[model samples]
Target chain A: MDIVVENLVKRYGNVEAVKGISFSVKHGETFGFLGPNGAGKTTTIYILTTILKPTSGRAIVAGYDVVREPHNVRRHIGVVFQDPSLDDNLTGYENLYIHGKLYGLNNTLLKERIAEVLKFVELYEFKDKCVKSYSGGMRRRLEIARAMLHVPRILFLDEPTLGLDPQTRIHIWDYIKRLKDEHGVTIFLTTHYMEEAEILCNRVAIIDRGKIIALGSPDELKSIIGNDIIYVRVDNNIDVCSKLSIDGIQSCKTIDGETIAIQVRKASEAIPEILRYLEKAEIKVKEVSYRRPSLNDVFIHLTGREIRDSGGGFIDIVRMRHRVR
Target chain B: MMESMYIMIYRQLKRFIRAKSRVVGMILNNILWLVFFGLGWAYTLRGPIASALFRGLDYLAFLLPGIFTTSIFQASFMGGISVIWDKQFGFLKEVLVAPTPRSLTILGRAIGDALVSVVNGLIMLSLGFMLTSHLNPLALPIILVIGLMVALGFTSMGIAIASTMRSPEGFQLIVGLLTLPTTLLSGAMFPLSNAPYWMQLAALVLPLTYAVDLIRFHLVGISFLSSVYWWLTPEIELLLLVIISVILIFIAIEMFKRTTIE
Candidate 1:
């Protein structure tokens, strides 16, 4: 394992931010801490990265215990925080040069690596430009480039795509995927975006309210609910719900008394049969849609609530950030 | 460690040079004080106006040392607000997670402020020489040495105070409150002799008092603040300032250590 957490717990006063969570990441794998805003995701990353101390449990990164060997962990790992950490006054090149120096990179290797990383991120042409002039996407790319200058074994990204446009978010994810394929660096990132987790993470741990409610590969997690979900919006919904209760249907739910959500192992095989039954009953279906189960559905099934904009997690992260320092 | 310190100091100097407003503001502050107060005091303290008060020294010459100390003290100490800036910008977290020892970051700020304040002090000194026309060519070396010492000492004091301050406005407000009272009590504007014993004790505790007294004694060969105690000699004040500066920098490192990911 490249990273391991053995019952990690972190508390601020009487509130527990992380409640004895345990998980592990294999080497070179993209392991995601999938949670909305303040589900203890940032706190866990902080503890694992040695930014904050855990109250009772411990985490080990790259064969070193975080509490006992923080320096070693820092030397070998890199981090890109949720917020922008770049110094706008400095040129992109200067910022990277200074970060290189801080990591004790030798003068020659620092120069070589700075050039290489900047070019890889396609930022070499604009390296001389002040960071203030760069767009949000460019700045995020530069921060990621800076994080990789030392070529760390593991990279920790705390909501790396937070507040960014969808286009920019895709650009960052492209680089993240490339890093794992080309360099084999272990990636441990946290995000509230379920699609991001589904696409990038090889395995994800669904965290909520400081606990790991579910953990598995994307396929494994979706398989737990069923293979597929079929939504049938019919005028005679009671007829469809009663008919879906027969064979080949894992479960059927009537939503708002308008649509019947039917889960089955084979959506393609069941849809035609369900259509036949509806036609025989003269049900007159209004609309129909079917797709595989998503991480969002899994979260809703587990928590019995949807992750929305007013997710109480955001305010806690912002309010506590200012008061702590 | 040494590499990080050198680069950090270089970064600070680069930042200082780029901040054109800061340079102009420091020069203007010095010019305003010298013309309005130094020249204004010149007319009142001339010939036989308590010769014992200034020890027969010219008032403008007397006023120059105090101005030098005040400017350097303000600039160097307030420069510590850069830490709060780094904190706000999220750069401090990046630096903290680096492999280098934590102390280097604090030391870098202290030394950078010290060097910048030294230059700032000399600029005020040159302007002081031009305005007063009382240049002591023979005393120039000792004056610069003492000036550098005062700059380093006070810059450390600034970093110590700044490390605990989370905002630049709050840092400036606290530094402003401190600068006024210390300047008044340091005998920068008048002699501390006839002041109450309690006021004298308060003056003794301020680091600026020692800096002003040391610079004045070096430039004009007179310092009544040193006569506060029989054993409070020039050497003792210098020793105390040095000790206080080291202690302050040490305190700054400790405060920097306590700073978190927030």
Candidate 2:
């Protein structure tokens, strides 16, 4: 394993920010922790990066203990934090140069790596511009380039695309993909975007309220809830599925006053049985749709609440500032 | 080990210089003190009757080292504003997460601030020469050395306080509370001898008192503490400044250890 944690806990006063969470990332794998805001994703990353200590547990990064061997862990891991950690006064190249220098990279190697990484991020032409002058997307790209300077074994990204536009987020994701495919570096990422985790992560741990609720590949996780979803908007009485014991109907939920969300083994096989059962009661159906179960469905199935409304919690000012910029 | 130290120093130097407004503002602030503040004080405190009060040297000559030392005090004290800015703006996270000792971070910042303070002192020194025509060319090195000690001593205090402070307003309030009384009590405006016993006792504990007395001795061949206290010659004042700098730097490192912003 490139990263390991055993019962990691972090408590701030009376609030336990992170409960006893245990997980590991394989070498050269892209692992993600997916959660909404205030879900301890960032705190877990802080501990693994050696910036914050765990209250009752420990993590090993790159074979070095995060607490006892922090310096050694630091040497082998790179981090692109969620905040605006770059100096706005410095140009893009200058920022990378300073970061490389801090990592103990000498001037000559720093020069070469700066050239390479800037071009790799496709920010070479804008390298001379001050970060303050760069757009939000450019600044994020530069941070990514800076993190890659020392060529660490594992790169940790805390909400790497928190508040980016669709196009810019895709652009950033392309570079992230290249980091794993081309460089073969292990990537540990934390994000709230379900699609982002599904697309980029090899395996994801769905965390909520300081605990990991479920962990697996995207398909495996979605499979835990059911294979398909049958959503219908019907004007009918409540307890719509009390007597329906169809073979394919796994579970049923009243999504709202006028809609019912059904978890099924196969939507094609299950929706006909559901329609027949409702039709016999002379129910008037407004709309009917069925599709593969999404990660959002999995979250709702496990938590009994939608992912976004589980008190997504505080507004991260750094991401807000990036948006305003 | 030293590589990160040098990198941190370079980062600070580049940051200090690249902010054109700050560079211009620092030089302008230096000029304002020398041309206006120093001259205004000298006019009120000069002439035959005031000669004995100022210890025989003209008030402008006496005010030269005072203003120069004042620049060191203000520049170094305000230098920690960058630390606060870094913390608020999140740039300090980059520095803190790097595999560098916290002491070296404080040290590099202190050295960069001290160098900048010396530059401000030198500019004020030149402006002093223009206004007073009393700068001894031979005293440049001594003025620079004393300026460094003053800068380092105050810069350490400023950074230490900044490490503990959370908000910019809190930093400003605390810095003002600290640097104001110390600058005033160090006898920047009036001679220390003219101050009351209570104020003198207050001034004795301030690093600025030692800085001003050392710079005064070098620039004008006058010593306030050395004349009153036998052990406080120019050499002793320099030693005090050095010790003060070391203690303050240690305090800054200790305080920074408890700072958990990143």
Candidate 3:
């Protein structure tokens, strides 16, 4: 492993921000720290990048202790913060040039490297323009380019595409893939987007409330609950809890009056059995389909909350108020 | 370590030179002070105090060096506002996470402000020459050196305060409160010799006092320190200033290390 964190603990005043979390990333692998808001994902990144010291335990990046050898750790890692860090007053090229110089690049090589990184992010044409003139997406690309200017062994990106549009987010993903494939750089990224984690990460650690709840590949994590999910929609409101009390159904819950998601050991074997029971119960099923379980399901199964809530709570409230009326 | 320091200094100097608006703002500020205050006083008070203040030199000659050094003081004192902004904008994180030493980071920023102070001082000196023919080539270099020292020390103080400030607005409040007292106490606008005893005492406590005294000594041959007490002049003040600057730089480094978001 190129990065190892053991029982890491960070506290802010009376609050324990990162409560005894531990994970490791191998050399030249893309690792994702999956978590929701205030889940200590950024706190972990800050500790690994040597921007924040661990209050207890230890972190080693590229064989240098983050606390003892911060300078060495800094030398080996490149970081793109969650916030924009570029100098708004300077041109994009000048910003990169300064970053390169700070990292000890000679003037001649700094110029060359600036051009190379700008091309990598596809911002070479606008390199001479001040950053203030660039859009948010453009500035983000520039920040990513600046972080990679030094060719670090490990690149840490904290929510790299948080506020970017869908198209730009996908473009940044492609750039990240190229960086890892061509340069063989280890990437550690944090994101709340399940698809981002599923697409980019070879392995992931799901963190919530400053604790790692699950750790595995995308397929492996989905396998925690089951292989496939049976999605059913009924025409009328019914008690899903009562309907779900049938055999061969591993677990089931009402998504709404029209939709219910069920997990089973084998959807091929269980669906037929489930349909027979529903028919015997005189339940009118409008739609049914068998599909692989997504990270959202895994998250919902583990955290008891939807990864992305789809207005279910609001709809429920409105239904209650309407019934009263 | 030295090579890293050199790289940091070079990067800082480059940023200082590239920001044209900052340079223009500093020049405009110096010009306004000269026109409104320096020239205004000369025109209104043609009394002996004003003439004696200038000595045999032109009025601008005496006022120019004071204004130049004061400009340097103002620029350096306010320079750390950028550091506060950097913290707010997240650029400070980039710099803090670099392989460079923390003290070098503080020194590099101070050097950046020092460079600006030098440039602004030279522009004011040049403008003074154009407005008046009182040219003392020998005294010019001395005034420049003193201005640089004062600027460097004050920039260190700014960084020290900024390192402790949580926000840019907090930094502005502190800078504003400190700048007025320091400026008035240093006698940047008037002679301190005839000022009230308590005011003189307050002026003596400020670094700008030594700065203004050094400029006055070079320009008008009026030494705040008598010949018998020549050793107690700016040498002591310079040493004290350097010591205070070193301590403040150390504090800033410690704050940087502690406050960096991990």
What is each predicted model's overall lDDT from 0 to 1? 0.82, 0.84, 0.78
Per-residue lDDT tens digits for candidate 2, residues A59-112, read 999999988988899889889999879999999999998898788898899999
Go through the candidates in order and give each one's DockQ. 0.70, 0.75, 0.48
lDDT of 1 by residue, B96-213 (tens): 8888888896687678877888788788788887876665757778777776667666776777776777889998898889878988998777778889999999998898888888
| After superposition, candidate 2 runs with Cα above 4 Å error | A232-248, A254-260, A265-290, A309-325
TM-score of each: 0.88, 0.92, 0.88
Model 1 over residues A1-325: C-alpha lDDT tens digits?
A: 9998999989999999999999999999999988766789999988888888999987999999999999999999999988888888889999999899989899999999999999988999999998989998899899899999999999999988887888898989999999999999999999888888998999999999899999999988887796687877777436567655458787777653566668888889898888888888888887677877788667756775444432323222333444698
Q: What DockQ was computed for model 2?
A: 0.75
By DockQ, highest first, what's the ranking? 2, 1, 3
**In model 3, what lDDT does residue A194 have?**
81
Predicted complex 1: CAPRI docking category: medium
| Candidate 3 accuracy as lDDT | 0.78
Q: What is the lDDT of residue A172 in candidate 3?
A: 91
lDDT of model 1 at position B149: 66
The all-Cα superposition gives candidate 3 an RMSD in Å to the true structure of: 4.3
lDDT of candidate 3 over B155-176, digit per residue (tens) = 7778778877778888889889
Q: Residue by residue across B20-111, what tens digits does model 2's lDDT show?
A: 89889888987877768777777777678788888787778887888789878888888888888988888887887787787777788888
